[model samples]
Target: MNLFTDIRALVIDSLTALQSEGALPEGLDFANVTVEPPRDAAHGDMATNAAMVLAKPAKMKPRDIAEALAAKLLQDLRIEVAEVAGPGFLNMRLAPDLWRGVVGAALEKGRDFGRSSMGQGRKVNVEFVSANPTGPLHVGHTRGAVFGDALAALLDFAGHDVTREYYINDGGAQVDVLARSVFERYREACGLTPDIAEGLYPGNYLVPVGQALKDKVGDSLLDKGEQFWLEEVREFATEKMMDMIRADLASLGVEMDVFFSEKSLYGSGRIEAALEELDAKGLIYEGVLPPPKGKPDEDWEPREQTLFKSTDHGDDVDRPVKKSDGGWTYFAPDIAYHYDKVQRGFDELIDVFGADHGGYVKRMKAAVSALSDGKVPLDIKLCQLVRLFRDGQPFKMSKRAGNFVTLREVVDLVGPDVTRFVMLTRKNDAPLDFDFAKVLEQSKDNPVFYVQYASARIHSVLRKARDAGIAVDDATLKAADLSLLAHEAEMAVVKKLAEWPRLVEIAARTNEPHRVAFYLYELAGEFHALWNRGNDLPELRFLQEGDSSATQAKIALIRSVSIVISAGLGILGVTPAEEMR
Candidate 1:
């Protein structure tokens, strides 16, 4: 039902006909031949570079090839006009019936209209928001969570078996800090003045974790040394922190299919198995890494260590697997995690990380490449920082998170839908400004509001039509005589609607869910444009007084617009509004 795909297939069929007629070479490659909307709409409805791309290979003039192609394409009823533009670019205008048919297709498909098989059921593992289980998630993690979740949804819409995953950083020094922080809370719960030291977590959220610890053991570790309580407290505190994180994610409508833990990798021989896989390929070695480029860590020492031969797979240098003290480096488990994903038989992998972790991108890709022997592709999307603003001034602080703005705080102020949409209004690698005032504003400047308002406006039209006794449902709309929708403005909306399935595949293939946001905004813009025109032109309106046939056609068109809008928002994890509150 994708109009663009249907048209492109027509173009390919015509080209094959041209080949059969001896106008083109017997074995001309049409891979580069593309049919898309012309940059300047004034030129035509759709443009193709078929003639231009084949001219050089076929040893023919561009205009000569375009002229023959245009003549052949015009034979199809779907194409009304096919003409050659500058340098033999063939611009073709489709018939009004074709655009009208797209509306019928949308009404028939509903929210599933744009769903595609671009991914071909390939298994994909997307690991994102793998924050340390030391504390609750903060604003920094929110962007990653939203981006990753949206990406998984987009791929799912594009037909991938996507697994939403979170890799817990529990094996790091951050969890050790969590152990000490909880010990203070445990003492405070026991009626003892707790030492809230400088290096500890002082958030009120952990106060309950401390209380829970007292209830579990009745202050058995009261006035005890770190040796006796550290291990017991660390495990208890990590569980509580993870619970808080899960609740925070639920508040934002994000749920992970897998929560792979780094600590689990420690004692379970998973890390050993991953390294062994690498070792079997001779990618593991005992070597000393050269002094790192740029300013080195103060603790950087020249010592022989176990290293992964990542340089063989495009890394700048080999990276340490185990530090000099025999403890695994942070990179070790990450490699193992990717190895596990590859072994799980995913055809593709994507990692979402903060901008500060840019250096890890190359090494992680190298590790996945070595692990998969380049059989699978890995893409890492680094989300830039989000700067929150209130009243044009930078907003900061989190009473619960101690210093950073927690994700729960952002979701509390603005519901999960607003938070998620605003986070995606910008590219993943670009800085985003989350203005509290602007986002909630009902004006068109707010993209979330703009998109939701369009959906709401559709319901408004439906209600108006229903009160007048005009039966309104997708099944009726699809069966309506859509050819009655012959207005130029109505056709423009149909053209925009035709872009959805193509847009979904593009966004999924690029692993950029932000593209979906941008596309939805643009689609909503066109819808609003047509809705506004109805005020000046009564015949252009969805409801035509005393003309049931025309009204049905118009309703089918606008109803299709609503259908595509809902599907686009669904991929973005935003609720399509029926009416703005």
Candidate 2:
């Protein structure tokens, strides 16, 4: 049901005909030919560059090729007008019935209307929001979580077997700090004044982890030294922090298929095994890395260390796997983690990190490339910072998170749907300003609200038609007299609907789910434009008074709009509004 694809196929067939007639060279490459919407609506519904691309290769003038191709395309019933516009661009106007079929196709397919098979069932692993299990997730983690989750959904819709994953940083020093902080709470549970030290976590969220520890083991570990209780409390507190993080994600409708533990990679011989694989490939060596560029490192004396030959795989320089003191560097475990993923047979890997981790991207990619031998591609998306505003003023930090606004704070203020939608309104690498005042406003400036309102308006129209005894169910509307939908405004909406499948594939291929949000906004604008036109042109309304045939045809159009909107919102993990308040 992809009209553009269908039209492009026709163009290819016509070019083959030209080859058969010897009007063009035998076996001319047609891969560069493309059929898409014209830059200006006045040009035509679809434009093709077949003539332009083939002109140089065929040793013919572009206009001659375009005119010949246009004549052949005009023979098809689906194409009404095919004309040469610019030097070689062939713009086409499709038959109204062809555009009308889009509405019927949407009804028949429902939410699966725009789903694509471009991914061809490839397995993709998306890891995001690997926030340290030290406290509740903050605003920065929220953006990553939302972006990652949406990307997974988009890939799923585009026919990829997507595994949503989280890498737990509990194996790091941060967990030790969490244990010390919880130990303070454990002491507080023992009716003593706990010292909230400067280098320790000061958030009250750990008070419950403290209470849980007290409940599980009572005051037994209260007076114990750091060695006696550090391991036991660190394990207990990290589990609590992960539980809190899971709850936070649930509030925003994000669920991970796998929660990989950094600690699990340790003490399991996994790190050594991963490095051994690299060592077998001669990628591991003892060497002294040159001083890093762009900054002075006073302590940057040359020290021989175990390193990964990352430069061979496109890194700026070889990276140290083991520090001079022989402890594993932070990069070692990450290498092992990706190697484990490759061993699991995922065809692709995607990591969502905060923008601050930009410098780590190249080395991580190099490691994955070496491990997978460039068989599996890795994409790291960096989410820039989010600045919160309320009443045109900077939002203050949360008392729970201490120095940052918690994800719960934002979700609590505007609920999950708004939070997810607003977070994705901006590109992942672009700074986003989350203004409570603007996002909550019921206006077109708010993309989430505008898109949701369009869905709500469709539901409202369907309800009215049903109450008036006009059958508006999908089955009925799909089988309705769609030929009666001849209005120019109605055709414009159908054209927009026709672009959904194409848009889905583009967004999925680029690994950008924000494109879905942007497309939904544009589709909503088209729908709203059509709806506003109905006020001035009585015949343009969805429900024509006393004309059941006309009413069904128009209802079919807008109903299709809702179908696509719901699918788009579904990919974004946002609930399509049934009614607006």
Candidate 3:
């Protein structure tokens, strides 16, 4: 029961009635008409731009259209007041019973109160945290993991068949580097003086990988050169690193539906098949790209190579698929991967990347566009860097992760709930400061705490009501005399509850889950405001003394708040606090 959408339909019906009655023109498009909350609460509960948008198309004055529309709307029993504001804007106040119905709907629906069917069951593939399997996931990957997981959850709530995937970057030079680094540790484990090369990984985290390799193959690989052992050790070390990465993600409550390997694309004829599809469309060519803008002549080397005509699909320049050495560039496997996704019949694709990969976005989109032949849409979200601070000072790096803070370190400090909620406190494109001291602080400034506290408070009320021998179960509270909830303070919270379904559609449409976090905070604020108001007025309190009926009515209102909070936190992969310690 989306109140805004329900009311908008009423507005549209009224507009059609106006046209039928000859009070308005015969034909007018209502697509641009919108029903949303007024900028100022003083105006009304909701505002519509129907008259403003249709006036020009219908060849009528703005005020005349608004006045006529307002009269038509006021005839409906759900609309308590319909006032025409300046320039054909119609502001409306819905009947109190309509707001009361939102509370009942929430109790009836429980966590499903705000779920939407906006996506209409479209298949969506969200690929995120595709970090290299060379080490544990760092803080940047943590943000992407949280963002992508939450986005997948949000899309699922919006009725999309979402597949959470991780693309393993094992078929690259980095995995070879990881093997050499582990070989040094293997040498160390074998009681030899190991040469820790400068370019090889220098983290102590590889000590276990080395010890494991020694345990598996023993001294047989001790005296062998790269040619004798690199392949065997590379596959072994890559699996160990992937094991560590999986544990890191599991610590944060992120689970992928698929773990795709880049190595599979290399030997399976998939890359050639993807390129062949593009070649059939005349998108593949042998050409030389111009020198990059900032390159000096001495450093610029132009060579004819196998390239993809990415410019034809929106990229700024054509991209090379194969270098002059006949080796596939990094972009080649990526194209194959997305092409594989398209072949799987997904209707849409979303990739969550780090801020440093901003330059790679256009080329990737172009590749997917060319591969899918403009059928599937790809949305790439870039998560900026996360700067860690402890006690207002820069936090130290994790020795286990070489030089960066591991996602496990942050989760260990504050647990998964706080970690997940705090990561999404900002948008994906904005830089976030994760302050250990501040996020753990039990105050309003902490959004995770604030939202959780609201849930805890609601539970506390239910427990108190239960102990007092009042029935506060969902079925009972839902059947309460909700008409008793006529107080302005109670209505304010209900109005916020009514906005949840609308907010979910907005967030899903923009592919921004941060909006859900923001809406949860605002809903908590409204709930807390009503909770504070009860201090000055006894009638506003949840447990009204000697009146079980009144208490049930008020408890119903707060129970509705808990329902929405749980749903919102679920989308964020956060566990709502039953009671905040």
Q: Best candidate, TM-score-wise?
A: 3
TM-score each candidate.
0.97, 0.98, 0.99
What Cα-based lDDT does every candidate model obtain?
0.90, 0.93, 0.94
Report RMSD (Å) for each prediction in the order shown.
1.4, 1.2, 1.0
lDDT of 3 at 440: 95
Residue 50 lDDT in candidate 3: 91
Q: How far off is residue 306 in model 2, in Å?
A: 1.0
Candidate 2 clashes between residue pairs 3 or more apart in a chain or in different chains? none
- Between candidates 2 and 3, name the one with more favorable TM-score: 3
- TM-score-based ranking: 3, 2, 1
- Sort the candidates on lDDT, descending order: 3, 2, 1
Candidate closest to the true structure, highest lDDT:
3
Could you tell me the TM-score of candidate 2?
Answer: 0.98
Q: Put down candidate 3 lDDT per residue, 248-320, tens digits, no spaces.
A: 9999999999999999999899999999999999999999888888846887788999999999999999999
**Model 1 vs. true fold: TM:** 0.97
Better of 2 and 3 by lDDT: 3
